[model samples]
Target: MTTPTAQTASSLRAAGREPPLPFAVTLDDGRELVMLRVLRILPSKRIVGEAETAGSRMLAKLFIAPGSTRHWQRERQGIEALAAAGIPTPALRHAGELHGGGHVLLTDFLADAASLSDHWQAVAGLPASHADALAVLAPAFAMLGRMHAHGLVQDDLHLGNFLVSGGELMVIDGDAVRSLSPGQALQADQAAANFAILAAQLPAGWDEHIAPLIDAWRQDGEGLPTLDTAALRERITHTRDARLKDFLAKTLRDCTLFKAEKTFDRLTIAVRAEADELAEVLADPDAAIAHGSLLKDGGTCTVAKLEHGNRPLVIKRYNLKNTRHALSRAWRPSRAAHSWVEGHRLAFLGIATPAPLAMIEERAGPLRRRAWIINAWCPGEDLATHLAPYVDSGPPPAEAEALRTLFATLYRERISHGDMKATNLLWHDGHVVLIDLDAMQQHRSASSHARAWRRDRARLLRNWPTDSALWRWLDANLPPA
Candidate 1:
């Protein structure tokens, strides 16, 4: 409904025309939308700078169009259905008809305090327990399932539209959401077609997420239309056949079968390949520091002096075989959620982690079939080495200081080092370092809603009970900060 008005002003005789006034832009599609400016900044060399905050300051997204009341009602009802099913779309901020055959709908920007795409790159290479990935990604799949269960169709299935805040993915953009009614198998087919369109837009690797998504859809069934058994099985089969399906198995097998030296060598090759890919994609690829393996040959998965591109970094290839929990998921993190968790922890805690680099699915080959984590390198020394002599005799002053600093660091960020064993800790210069943090507990209040939240909490606590207690005791016994 907002129209452009001319601001008439008498200017110097030869003055040129002024720039166009920023308007509230909204699309017309039988729905009303209002564009709210939450944050505005000048483009640098034509590229928009990323929003560093949770987009508390953001512009409104408007979707407006003219259509019959019945059509609008269907869409509105669909939105309501999704919201009712606990899928957090924007609350209807406002709606109204314009003078012309146009309408507008306004809603809050779906901003994630932590986006999975944003953080997954950082921890992709961390040495995580097998259960860690599942702990993080299962809920995300559940979220997607809830949307589908409620008869809400996600028209756009790209990674960009999905937001991960407080350890959950909330769907936005309702234009493509399809709310189905009973006896509407045909309509459901249409919805599926729309989803197919979106799927075609996704990268090749993302096909693996589909089955879990459909299963989630079924589990979150809220009196909504259901996929037939044959259809469901077909979806599951397709997803199982994706390239990532065997990655976990291969990665675990490699960790067990390969020697430490061989493992490091494989890691190096993967890193080099990743670097080549990054060189093609990154804006300043040269600025990125790539490291292959930190500690190999049965040494602790730790590093000393990351020394990569003058940017302190840590890159860990999680040995998924080491943890008992990994066995449950067949020794692979579900949905790669562990990497995101760890990445967010390092970044939010103001640790010396470089901005996340990239997440490359490292495969040994088509025949051998192996995969592993390859992350940006961090600069530091393994705490095990730093503390070995100390534990043998007396704790070194440097080791104590390192531990103290690490505790303070994680505490400040409210990130718990879930597996804070001596081997996973690191010491560098005068700082305590935390590595292999993909499995750490870093949930927000919102994440507590996941069905698996309580179970995960209990399991996490059970697996690391002594560690948590010891950390608490250590905190109490340590000298005052």
Candidate 2:
């Protein structure tokens, strides 16, 4: 059987012929269930649907692939075991093979529960206070501890596998759940590893809640091994960092959230939208750059403003500075790629930056030439411009606080802006936004990072002449050595 493409499924739905339901199946105990609405399409061509019987409403997972009955059996066993262990799980209704070439498992439908992933997304979008966020996530941490105390391991640790409703936490999709020996519980190391996997999927600022979350979990985790909170925090950070790197690499290569097309040999364009309009610009990037309103023009690079989809955008072209520079960059990745990746990295770290729309590069056989990175126009002045009038006096408390938060984030993340000039930092929407990210990178060694931080501080101080009040204020407020 051919798997259905999203487009085909959409077309079928438009014609009111998709989600074929109202199908009947007989349970192992001879009860009949009528599947009413398709809930979702699972991997391996299986279908999850809402079903009804004479007595109740249910959820039915129909496995259509050949030789999939064994999976249904495993899921049934896992759910039963988990429920027997006093864990919250969906009540299993029936499990059996369909007459024609499939297997079916039925369970009670969760009426008002939402997946943990969805809940997290919703809560993360709100302008909630730190205390509120901690309050929301404390229960989830406690639930994981309960599972570990009972020797239960959810191999598929995705947030979507857990559900929340009426102040209760429950686990779903039990196919990958595992158990230790009858009398055993999760060791400290195993429990920490499990928490790390789950925490890695939380929002970017989850690190702030780690201590409180662990404390809450420990309170409820009776009989569980004692956890080393520091070790668990380190493990969570390490795991999250690795995942971010992999995610950035994949996004750049595949333009996962953007549209990408190779318009010409050795010339590829990636954009957030309006591919046709962007294609015209990429056709001859130099001509487009020349015609756009110039923001900066230097021997090595050019920045310009252009309009796309009725919104202003800024494009920065990275040109060869000189013969030596051209030779050095010939076979290396374009600076455009660097900025694109760094832009995404900052966003993932919950730092503010201009939204990168697209990047275009011209390449020869093993040689990269001119490149351009386009960003949505940010509507605020640079820090230098914003603070020019304050040179004779100190910056206001709010501005000082913003600067402190920005530098503290940089210090904590080990990110160093090679050239930390005030002009490269924008004051936008009550926060600071870093731009020109080609020189931004996270260093590995403490010594190297410190060296970069010293340089950044020196550059920032030099923004004002000697004996300036702003400079003195900044020096006084600089992040501690």
Candidate 3:
């Protein structure tokens, strides 16, 4: 393909701008292809672009990294092999090294196709019935089973690598495809492993549908193994948990870190906020706290309402009561950190909570003086206040259902709000939003979870007092451990 000259490269890099579209690349056979849009940019100086030659649309992948020709060749071999085996994949048009030190591969572009990942997101957003969701996903399971029956294994098998077009599931990115024997079916163990890879990508809270999906897969192939649903569920859960932990670690590490120039104090903002404005607040937190509208002023902590960029927020300041308390909290993580992490954990688990904005901690040498956490202010009455009128008669059906959903989510995730008093829950948008995440935690041991669960229920019942109608209703309707 045509090499980018120094002048062209300079113009592309002007003002740190990306290369403009509708660029042209000439193949070794003197055919000129014009790229219309960039698809993806990979590490190692590789780019995939949507290109056109004559009147046909094509996908062109260019690799500029040294020794990329071998990789390109391997991908070509995979595509050819799968295509020869009657597997659906893009048709390869050309593969060759460019005049410069790079390589390029061209393939026919599948128009009107969406990646399985994108399709899943769209379907999940729709107000579709459970049957509709199953119909959409069942075909993907069948296709996966068929591939394993044919002894084809995709090393990087994820929803993103498959495409949905014209009511058919098509596999792409053939570079990772492997075959056991020329035509022999995969072994039972290999099939199970491949199935686990696909299962790990299913959306959370869909564990109930695993058996049905497995049945659908088995209907498509005769030689498939009889997968143990429980065993497979464990494997999928383990993989999903590991991936979530890694994602959370990376998110926290890469979040914006703000340092107060004058106080040498530090703050970390989880969500995007104006650095200068936030820094001003962190530099003199006491003054800001004093000026803001106070919500609570207790011996151990204080809460206030403040605004940034015309957006209201609630800031909770955890105070060190005495010299002993200050010394104890000096070299350890502040309560603000715990709240920040628990808030994110709840969000990740799909539980409703006020959005956490930022966390600030002040220290004197090795002694931490105080810490603060800021969250988006949500307008709603606390659950106890909201349910006061219904305590004697029990909540309305809709409200009762909402409460049951809240507890069900917590139970399914093995999470317990350490202080589950009704005041810590809010009635908003027809759902219960959890607050005061400083003590929220997920338990790994069933016994520990049961103990915390009992405590949570007891605290919740205290709001209703005695064996009131509301208490009786909750006792009947709340999910069991």
Candidate 4:
């Protein structure tokens, strides 16, 4: 039986979040660092955690990949460079080799600091033009401006890299931070390319509204233009498209975000941090389905809600009726695999969907058979039932706005939900979450998308009587195909 290993960083990362912590590691100088909680892991390669040294708390990075000298040196140099350039970064406290192999680095832990990523998430669901959205984003761009003025560039410029402490923004992730030219403002093109990296991380429709905040990216002494230029926006679009391509690829592999195992006979993958909790379900999904509370038992698929620890999860099984049905689906990717990939795609686009946790497929050499996909359960009521009372009248304010935003985003991204019944849309946490995404697609060609979206739009309208006030309002409000 092939099972997850215990000691290697790879298996430890695949272990569920809250893996046996307070792990001790001896430094080259004979001092020991006891890690109590992990903050992040680059599976099989590195780990960042909160640790103790002689009774004092600090942050530590363990570069566990064998002979990981190149990354270690770059990290050391990057932090040192940020300090030299007068950027506010976590102060480096220690750097040395681990007792046997790999390397370790330590830095001061800011107990009160919060990542900009968390702050952004609080306002991300708001309309793109809302003041709160701009408020959370301005400081990040202003901080990036300061880095540019110092000729510093962070390749992965996202909210998580900036921390809020004592009413100030502090930069981290030194490994991705480097210099174009020290103590000199970046040239026009160089600054655009760097800024685009950050902009690409923002939600869709934000690129059009960032013009007002362009001033924030120009520090008092940067000697840069105040206006948002056309070239910069175009660069942001290009980068964003390329990033989406890269992210979808990560969904199927054993990366930091996922733990995957693939073979011609079988394929399985799960959220890296939750793999351990989901092992029993993965080891024998049929047995799990037999014991679970079945939600559906159809000819094509079956669904059941189950729990691991305190977290509720939904598992879906794609069934084959008989030999003919099995042979037909054998040559194609299972619907379960398709939903897994599409779920990740929706998340990357900032669209709402049940968080995909795992995917499994049974195969005969190159041929596929029964398969399953698991998702974090969404407990919200379906849109059809939620709106039953509002059929004669329009939806409430929150529902109205959320519906607009969801469709507008879909139109902007050229996405079409193949089955547009209201039952597949769930009213969740102040937004409408998309479900049953095996047939969903984001079209590349504008003309082709229009044709498909017409079908989707008309299908949704057919859900209600033509004369219902809700139906009329949606027809007028929704974006044209």
Candidate 5:
């Protein structure tokens, strides 16, 4: 028969083995929680209180539990009562058999996540006479009142404890709820206490904020009292201490009111959107030209020369907004997609581009919604630089031969160089080179076939213009070698 310690070890391994054995575990990134290995410098306000494994949505609570059986029992009893009352609480997914004087519990994951506290913070930052934060506040109060009406006492009530996801609120970590006798006055007292907690943390002039909200909540509530405003205000001031006030103040500064749903797949819709925006910009002759030349040239993008893989490469950075004023507030996946598309085009076209080295996507930087594309450097003089002399010199035989092969290679492959300007072509080491291969498209259909053909024809006209009178001059132009 297996010893109890061996069974426990087997159970822990079955759950999930964390690194560094019996004590240390990884939470996120480099952050680790050392249960028994380290002496306390500062105790974690949040500790891993639960590791419930038997649920569709595995939940682990941090920093909420006081590590007492009483707390655990309170949570378990409250959950059962709330479910009976029809207020949504996480289905007691799984709770450890009471052992070592404590147990852990798990529940279903919440969907459609948005924090009421975050919404309030956004309101605080904006200069406004209009109190718009009530949009979320009224519903929040209604939910709380409904919970209290059902004879559920959430001992630990805070904004974070209530989660709103997918248009539903799921009360979590109920280790502190007290079940009141039906129709008891305890519900009202609990609600008043909870409101006081929220109100104290509210900014100055909160009376104006709460008055309208309470009125709205009262109007919608069933058999609820008309809220006592004066009592509420006094309670807020009396209950909110300096430490709590300081913490709420920090939350206001740190929290974001809204967050976009992030999808982690390699190719995401957000990334595609940015790519489309860039493709449009690159297609614009003026915008492309200006960017090609930097601000002095009035472009929407900037190009710099950089060294990579022992080669001189051109670096392209898109200016999402014309000025910094137009920058986005977060990383734009579209920017990443656009850079990836350009790099892919170059690689497919067999152009001399630096191996795309790395890309830096600034999701939440000053230039939010922006992306950077880096590639191996290609060294050579641009084709336009070499062609400018020949425009007057008349296409030299050697250069003309190289030009024919270059065009032939690209055109035969049914590839369209979106910006086929002469300047983007290069001449290096007696070989024709091409750079700035943005706005590339693969002609996969009949329409694209026609478009690609026309583009190639136009390029020939620009570089080797055959005078209406000079058939041989037209003939002199061949696809670039």
Candidate 6:
């Protein structure tokens, strides 16, 4: 943290700038709030951070945008509503205009608290029906139900908006909390629609396990509004589809999750969290690949293992082969970009894949040439090698269970791995991790997906002989077209 120094809101709002911490912004009351750690920022719009004003720590939200009073007022009103509606929220401690042209809002800070999103990570890999996973989520939905019963709704309902501190599950992000039809419980349709946004946060096909969670909601709900389970399911499917489209669209732009740069001569995008760790490699990928240990250096692609700090990374370069081949692929998105997006998609759906770190495309104007994708190295062996000993018999129970789980998710989401070769499946930590995702596709149409699913199933089974026990086992166990 930097020493406390006064900074102008105008200066900090310049294009893509942020105030250096720990910096002070004078409040309308003439007291200085010194921010020590930045949490999240929307460039020139607003900034959230940890701050102190007079020996007390609080979460400070500086609405530094050109017209921020309206937003600041919404935050204050929302917090007030939460208290009036008997919903738990951090007490509003400070609300005032910035010395310059913005506003400041501060609330009690819970240093030991964790967001539901953070807690959910621990049990997210477990089956959604597992008791532990349900326990973590049940309370969050119960809180939402209580809000609805009290005639309030969290417009942007997600796990992150709930905080667990001192054994209390408290609602947060007052800006998202608002009232509907004052003094009356939310109608069944209104409540279900709001709940759909929250329900869609879980993985697809977990809907069967969701009935129990609604009971948890009913326990806290007032007036006990009847919810149509079928309608809720339909709403969830549509919300999930819309969310997937929005997330994929964000992949090509600069956003919180990704740092992207597009130029006529080049295209570079990296997972924002990995930007500092992989800076050297992202700066000059080809140079790093040249110095790394080569895994495969011919054909349509080249793979290499590189040592970065204490970690190992795998980089794959999609070779141009010839000028003719480059021309054929010029106008379309590069294969590296496709792999990067698909990798994130799989990870988003809770499927296993090597964590994609970054991707770059060498371009001349609008035309693309060679490209490279960087991923965290997986220590597990490929299925072809790992299962070589079990060819005559079925694999171990753990391995079989992992494959079943992976394919179940793929089928539920209508995801098809175009290349289902044994080498593309890696056995990592008792889970099957998919790689070589350049041709992977998640279908939007059921009919098109059925056709693609058939081809994938056949290709996967082709890895073993027709009469082999392992092949027969998979042919029967795996989901069919």
lDDT winner = 6
Q: Model 3, 168-282: lDDT tens per residue?
A: 6788877788886557677777777777777766645666568778877777775776787777777778876876686456434533232222245554544544455566665
Root-mean-square deviation of every model: 17.3, 6.4, 6.0, 4.2, 22.2, 1.4
Q: List ranges where model 3 is wrong by over 4 Å.
A: 1-113, 122-129, 155-158, 165-168, 173-176, 180-182, 203-205, 255-327, 334-336, 354-381, 427-431, 479-481
Best model per TM-score: 6
User: Any runs in candidate 5 off by more than 4 Å, and if so which?
Assistant: 1-55, 61-67, 98-101, 126-131, 184-190, 242-481
Could you give candidate 4's per-residue lDDT for residues 370-423 as a string of tens digits?
A: 999999999999989999999999899999999999999999899999999999
Lowest lDDT block of 10, candidate 1: 43-52
lDDT of 1 by residue, 1-481 (tens): 3453221111111122221233322333333222233232211101111111122433232222223344345545656666776777656644444334333344544454555545444433322222443344445555655565544556545444556655556665455566654222224554454344433332222344455445544465454454454554444334433423343333333222111213321322222224444433222222222332335522223222244444444333333354453444443543223553355346533454433443322224321112233345545666555544443344456555455555444443345555545555556545555556555664444343232334433332232234454334454544333
TM-score attained by model 4: 0.89
Clashing pairs in 6: none
Q: What TM-score would each prediction reach against the true structure? A: 0.34, 0.73, 0.72, 0.89, 0.40, 0.97
Per-model lDDT: 0.41, 0.75, 0.73, 0.86, 0.49, 0.88
On residues 71-110, what C-alpha lDDT tens digit does candidate 5 reach at each position? 4566667778778777777676654432222244445544
Score residue 203 of candidate 5 by CA lDDT.
42
Better of 1 and 4 by TM-score: 4
Whose TM-score is higher: candidate 1's or candidate 5's?
5
Against the true structure, candidate 3 has what lDDT?
A: 0.73
- Runs of candidate 4 exceeding 4 Å displacement: 1-38, 52-56, 64-67, 97-102, 219-221, 226-228, 263-265
Which has the better lDDT: candidate 1, or candidate 3?
A: 3
Quick one: ranking by TM-score, best first?
A: 6, 4, 2, 3, 5, 1
Find the 10 residues in a row with the least total lDDT in model 4.
1-10
lDDT of 2 by residue, 1-481 (tens): 2332222222322333234455565555556667677776643446677877776888888776666767777788779778977878788877776654567788888788888777766455333236666666677778777778888777667678888867678888878777764446689888888888778766445666577777766767678887787788788888888878876875465342555554344656465454566776666767777778999999878999887668888889999988898889877888998898888888777678998767887776657888888888898889889999899898887788888777887888889988888889999877889998988989989989998888888988989977999988898888754
